[model samples]
Target: MECCAFCPTESRELYKCPKCDRLYCSLKCYRNEKHWICSESFYKDQVKEHKPELMENEPQPEDSSSKNFNPEMFEDYMKTFKKDTRSEKEKNPQIRVRADEDILFDSDDEPDYVRVVAEKSLEEFEKIDMNDLDRKLTMAGLGGLTDNDEQLEYLYSQLNDEEKKMFNRLADNLQYDEMGLMNSVFGKNLPKKK
Candidate 1:
């Protein structure tokens, strides 16, 4: 069953608005609802006005070639182009209007689902102690010997299955390239070469 974009009601029958491409349950629901799709007649009239030449099958004058076109024809073309552009801008006024007043702000009454999910993910991420490894590495650095193999093993063990796979792939690529795995792991600045 398809749900109406505007309303909470769900229906098996989906009626798509020709103008805005929004779906509705019934004609009555659509008629009563305040949606951008309701302005279909206005758009239809615009379509009619913009393509005036398409509406009629008038034959071009044999004497009036493209090279010999009058200045009036050029003026008419420019006027038509300007009118069409203006009509398009008028149709989507919200997009063109820079003022905050002209913009249609979403109601704060409804909570955004995607935003809620993102916030939850961020909260979870914040709870994780990412600096724990760095602290451990810093303490280990106090010792003269920085055990790179042990550090790599520890880091690799801490990673999830997907992350471990990616790490392994990177290690494989580094091995195939005949460069120090340390250079690939810790970047060029590190003096360690293996």
Candidate 2:
């Protein structure tokens, strides 16, 4: 198990910092002196992501040429919108919210240890897999799907037996759900409406 980069606790459950990618065990450790810079930057990044318009200039209004508005056209638009929404909801009745899972790990459960290293060293690698490339990039260990496979394999390898069992169960559930969603969306083997 890898120890928390901030404090000396063996992190059973870990969260990777969005900005720095350093592993921290808890919120306290995440807000610590060493990790504070990254935490602050991560917060900023999140804000920017969620509210990108804050950085960009305000959008200009539509051209006055659209002043010739039609109420009949808007009524037709609303009818089509309602019809589509109702049909969509009826088509995907299997879509429902699932209960939230308790995946958070508490680092305070374990005894704290003094910080061992003053500064952490980064290991440099020659090859970096860029996951946004063309389909041919998959053969070179790149592309989104390839990256996801690699990540899942690495995380699965890090789990214990119990965790592995839970992970498999979750994966099975996800697979089932995915199949159901696909079948529903493509109107394959759907029950006839009475």
The best candidate in terms of lDDT = 1
Clashes of 2: 0
Prediction RMSDs, each to the true structure:
20.8, 27.3
What is candidate 1's lDDT per residue for 47-86, written digit by digit as tens? 6799766647534444454644433343553443323335
Best by TM-score: 2
Could you give me the TM-score of model 1 versus the true structure?
0.20
lDDT for each candidate structure: 0.63, 0.62
Q: Which stretches in model 1 have alpha-carbon errors above 4 Å?
A: 40-194
Stretches of candidate 2 exceeding 4 Å from the true structure: 52-194
Candidate 1 at residue 140, lDDT? 80
Worst 10 residues of 1 by lDDT: 79-88
